[model samples]
Target: MTSILIADDHGIVREGLKRLLEAESDFEVCAEAADGREVLEQVERTHPDVVVLDVTMPRLGGLETLEHLRAAHPDVKVVLLSVHGEPPVVQSAAALGVHGYVLKNGCATEVVSAVRAVTEGGSYFSPSVARQLVEQLRAPRAEIPDPLGALSGREREVLKLIAEGLSAKEIGQQLSISAKTVEAHRTSLMRKLGVRKATELVRVAVRYGVIEV
Candidate 1:
């Protein structure tokens, strides 16, 4: 049997995943945690074979929690799950030696497969995630240069604050700049980034590792 741990901030989500995992004859949920801190605590105690982790948890969050777990329990497999397949998170988790990654919507389709694959010492990434990774790898390496890299220091600062979810006024106050100036920088950054709106900016920010989703 494969001993597993389910870690997600939402109680309902965790319970749902637990039920699904438990339904499999060879899989069992040995532990469950509502957040990253609890995940660490439970894993140390249970020593589960696989960890199904959520990326947006409170405290340490999934990536950082996985970092700790990898150092402390190298034998355990890690499968990162999230609602959004942010490129930076996916790429960073890949670099950190994660066994697999699955999006929340893909949970029904990919979670079990990811768990089984990772437990068997193989890598698993959902089809959508695979497509996103390919896009990310190609986006920065494509015929065109990364426009964000062309940003001036002040423009980059503006984008960071925007990605942090700060209002124009708030960012201006933080940087001791006029709100109009902040807006102008936002416009410039969006144009350079080829993103039409704030939401797309956040998407780009996530891709570039400028912000966590």
Candidate 2:
């Protein structure tokens, strides 16, 4: 049987996917995780053949988790399920060597097909996602300005916390940095995002998918 690990923050979504994948005759639901940290932990413990991971989660996020997975378990296959089908997002996942890219809104059967294809040394993408990749390839290689590309990793953390309504002091405590340093990050974020007000920073964060609505 093909062992699989499912990772998503929503219990209902995980359960639904678990049931759907288990119905496949050659598939086995080996494990489940609620967040990216748990995903790494479960992957280490279960050593699943394939990982069905959601792009957004409480900690570490899908793309970040995929980075760690690639370094630690390069042989394992990852099939990302995301709400975003934008060219930048799909291109980012592809650049990271993701085996499959399936939209959350796509047909459920697509998920099954993705897993099967990847296991057989092929790749898969949702029809819309495939079209986006094709269009990107057909277009000139001019650099598409990524909104989040300007921010450093620390700035991204500060942006997320700010969007979540955390004060500078609170964010500093969580990141183990001084409140003054956090303030500096906030200033840099506003500058890079081209916003003057703190409220504008939150809007920019949302626009860049630094935080969900």
Best model per lDDT: 2
Error of 1 at 97 (Å): 1.2
Worst 10 residues of 1 by lDDT: 140-149
Which candidate comes out best when scored by TM-score?
A: 2
lDDT of 1 by residue, 1-213 (tens): 999999988889889899888888999999999877799899989999999998766544576677788888999999988876755557667666788888877649588899999888898998888887677777755553445446655675677668778899998897789999999998999888888887788777667655456
Superposition error at 38 for model 2 (Å): 1.2
lDDT of 2 by residue, 1-213 (tens): 999999989999999998999999999999999988899999999999999988876656677777679889999999999887766557767877899999989899999999999999999999998988887788777756456656555676677788889998999898799999999999888888788898998877666555678
Give the Å shift of residue 122 in candidate 1.
0.8
Clashing pairs in 2: none
Model 1 clash tally? 0
